[model samples]
Target: MNDRLGRLRDTTINLAHGSGGRAMRELIEDVFVMAFDNPALAALEDQAVFPLADLVRHGDRLAFTTDSYVVDPLFFPGGDIGTLAVSGTVNDLAMSGAKPLFLSCGMVIEEGLAVDILRRVAASMQRVAIEAGVSIVTGDTKVVERGCADKLFVNTAGVGVVPAGVSISARRAQAGDVVIVNGFLGDHGTAILVARQQLALQSDIESDCAPLASLVAAMLDTREDIHCMRDATRGGVATVLNEFALSSGVAIRIHEAALPIREEVKGACEILGLDPLYLANEGKLVAVVPAHAAERVLAAMHAHPAGRHAGVIGEVVAQPAGIVVLHTGFGGQRIVDMLVGEQLPRIC
Candidate 1:
C-alpha cells in the first residue's frame, strides 16, 4: 500500500485528489503543505481565520486586489503563470502601501492536461506565495473540456492591510515630481514573445515575474515622500502614466533617453516592430516621488534585490491638459496613446 501510494505521491495530482477523499488529503500533505508550510495554513480548513491587526485599532485601511493569469506555454523563461498570479496580486496591493497577508487562488485546468504540468504549476504558486510572506488561504479548481479551456489558468486574489500615515495612489502625482521604474523595461513581454512567437532571438531575455511586496514596504519605510506607486503591467508604462495623469489631472512627460531599455529587448523590439513603452512588464514598477526625494528614493530602490536597475523614466508636468507625452530620443514628442488594438492577447 505504501509503495502504491508512494508512486502516487511521486506522480501528479489525479482526479481522485480533487474528489475530496483520502487521495485529496494525501495530495495536499505531499505537495501543497510541503511546499508552503505555515501555521495558519496547516489548519487544513477551507477558510483560514486570522486577525488583521492595526496600529490605531480603528479598522485601519486595507488593500485588496485580484488578477488572473493565462500566459501561454505554461512556463516561461523566468517564471510561470502560477508564480505570476501570486506575484502580480501581491505587487498590486503592495503598490498601494499594503502589507500582503493572504491570498486565494483558483485553478482552471483543461480536461486533458498533464498531471506533472499541474504539479509544477501548483508548486510554483506555492513557492512564490511563501516567499512573498503570504498564505494561500483557500482555492478552487475546475476542469473544462479539452478545447474549451487553455492548458491552465490561475486567478489569485490578495488581501493586505495599510497602516496609518501611508497613502499612495495614481492620483498623487504632482508637478515637479520624478517618476522611477524598478528595473529595465520589456523583459517580461519580450520573453513571452520569444516563447510564444517562436522567435529565433537568442539573447536569453527573462521574465521579471517576481513578488515586490517586501520591496514596496522597504521604500515606504525609508521615506514618506513617495507620491504614488504602480506596476507596469498591461498597456505598460504608457498606460500607467496615462492613469496617473488622468487621476491627478496633470500632464506627464517621459524622457526617452532615461528610459531603461535593455540591449536584447531593444534588439527584439526592433526586429518585431514593437514599442517598449507599450510592452507589459510583470516585475517592474513606476514610482512617482517629489523631486527633492528623487535621489534618496532612487538610492533605496537600487539597494533592493528586485530594484537594482531602477531608473527615473519620466516626470509630472502641468501642461494645462491631462495626458501622457513621450519625448522621442530624436528630440521630439508624441502622445503615448492607450492601446487601441490587442498587441499581445492573453499576456497576463
Candidate 2:
C-alpha cells in the first residue's frame, strides 16, 4: 500500500488531468490511491483481484449494488459528496442483511475544479469507508468540460456477503409486522434545501448522512428474523413503506405521533411547505420486523449511535393491501403516497 500521499503540481483539474497519461496517474496515485490505501487498490492493476476463499468464509451469496451521487452542493454541514457516495453504496448492500466488504469509486470531474476540493472529497470517502469497514478496491475517473458536467459527480458500486440463514427483503414484510426506523428523518433533505438556497433559517439541521452497516449489524445480532430493511434515502420513509407494502402485498400504517423527527427539521419542512415524511434521509432506515421482535430490535437500535433515536412508527395490516397509510396526530388518517415530483433535486 502507498503509505505516502501523492502531491500534484496543478492547483485545479484540467482536461489533461483526465487524459490517460502522466497527469491522470498522479491524480490516482496521489489522491485516490493514497486515501484508500489497500493492497487491492495500491497494486494499480486494471482490476482488483481477491481470493474466492476470503468471500466464502463470510457467506455463500454475494450482494452487489451501485449508485450515483450528484448533490447540488458538493459539501454540506455534516458530510460531502465523497462521504455520501461511499455511505450510500454501503447502506444499499447492508439493507439485504449483508456484511459490506468492498467498494469501487468512479468520479466525473469538471475542468477547473480545485485540486484541493478533490483531495478533500477523497479523504472523506476513505474516512467513511473505514467507518463502514469496507475497502475501495477499484475505480475509474473522467474529466469533462466545465459546463458539460457539474463540479463533480461520483458513482460507487459495492459488494458484500450475506450470512447464512439471513433473508431480509422488502417483499418479506407481512401482516402483523412492525415498522421501525433508525434515528431522525428529513434532516438530509432539509439540510440540502437550506444549503442550496442559502436560507437564513435559524436551524441546526445537518444532513443525516452516515454509514448504517454497523447499525444494521447490531439489529441483525439482536434478531436475524428481520423481515424487511431499507435505508430511507432519496424518497425517505414514505417511499420505503410504500415499497414494502407493494412488494409484500400488505398494508403498512404509520403513526405521525410515533415518527422520530427533529424539531429543526420539522420546523424547516413546515416553513418550506414540505412533508418531512417524504424528505430525504441519508442515515436513516425503515425496517419491518416481526411484531414479537419489534421491541427487542428497537432496544438494539437504541444501543447503537446511528439508531439512538430509533422508534416503532407503525405496523402491517391485512386489509387495504399495496398501500401505506399514516395516522395523523390531528385525529385523522391520510394515504402517504409516493412523491409525485422531485422535491429536491441532486439530493443524495
Candidate 3:
C-alpha cells in the first residue's frame, strides 16, 4: 500500500506530479491535504458538499469572489503568493460585509520547482485559512513547462454569507459620508520593489498582506450602516476612491495630510518617482460611513489589531459628481484621477 501510494520526497517538481495518476494523488495528499486538513477535504472526493441549513443560518445571500495571484518574486519580505491569495479572496468577501466561510485554491507550478517550496506555500495557505476561520474545501493543481510560467502562481475562489439586513456597496455612499482607511498605504508595492534589489536602496518596508474578515466584522458589529468597504489593492487607495465616486455619482474630497503612509514607504516612493496613493496595499481597506456613525465605527476599527492605525481621510460630497479631489497640504486642491497607466505591474 505504501509503494502504491507513492511519495513526495524533498526534491523538485516534475511533470508527472500533475499527471492525475498515483503521483498526482500523492502530491495532493502529502502537501495540500496534510496542510489544509478538514473533514470536507479529507473525504478526497472531486467536490465538497456543505450543509444547506448551516449556510442559511448565517445569511440569506451568498457572496462569491475569485482572485489570481502572480506576484513576481514568489517570496517577499512579509509574505508570499500563497498568503496573498487567501487574504485577497477573504478581503473580497469581507468587502461586502460578508462572513467568509470556504475557499478553493488552484496552483499552477512550473516544472523544476522545488517540492519544499511548494510545501512552504501550502503551509502558508493553511495558516492564513485557520486564522481567518475558513476552510480550503476543494482545489486543483497543474504543472506547466519550464519557462512557460513563473516559479509559482495561485488562484483562490471564496464564498461567504452576508448577514441579513446588511447592505454594503460602492453606490451606497452619499453626501456627508466620511471616508476611513484602515492603515498605511503602499507598503506592499514598496516592499516588492525593494525585495527585487534592482535599486541599491535600503529600507524596512514589509507587505501588509493580511485577512480583513475580523476587522470588517468588527465594523459591522458596531453598526450595519457602513456605506461601502473595499480593500485598497492593485491600484491602491486612489483607484478605490475613483471607483466609489464613479459608482455613486458623488464627489470624494480627501485631505492630503490625513493620508497614512509609512516613512519607509514614503521615502521609497519618493526615490522611485511614484505616488504612495497609487501604490498597492494588501491588508488596508477604505470604508465610507455616515457622519453620525463615523466616530463609533472608527473607535471599533481602532480596537481591532488590523486597524489600529485607522484614520478618517476623506468625505463624500454632492458637487462635481463622479470625481475625486485631494485637498493638498499646500492649501491647494487637485483632482485625484484614475491611474492613467500601470504604475507598477505584478506587485500584487
Global lDDT scores for all candidate models = 0.81, 0.91, 0.91
Residue 340 error, candidate 1, Å = 1.7
TM-score of every candidate relative to the true structure:
0.91, 0.97, 0.98
Q: Give the CA lDDT, 0 to 100, for residue 340 in model 2.
A: 83
- Number of the predicted model whose TM-score against the real structure is largest: 3
Model 3 misplaced stretches (Cα beyond 4 Å): 1-4
TM-score of 3: 0.98
Q: Give the higher-TM-score candidate: 1 or 2.
A: 2
For candidate 2, lDDT tens digit of each residue in 128-179?
Answer: 9999999999998899998999899999999999988899988999888999
Residue 298 Cα positional deviation in candidate 3, in Å, after optimal superposition: 0.5
RMSD of each: 3.1, 1.9, 1.4
TM-score of 1: 0.91
- Residue 231 CA displacement from its true place in model 3, Å: 0.3
Off by over 4 Å in 1: 1-30, 54-59
Per-residue lDDT tens digits for candidate 3, residues 1-348, read 243355676488889988888778888888998899997886778899998788899899999999999997989999998899999999999999999999999999999999899999999999999889899999988999999999888999999999998999999989999999999999999989988985468877889999999999999998649998999999999999999999999999999999999888888887889999999999999999999998999899999999999999999999899999999999999999988899887987
The sequence of per-residue lDDT tens digits that candidate 1 reaches over residues 103-194 is 98777767666767877877888888878988887776665665877778889999888867887878889999988998889888898998
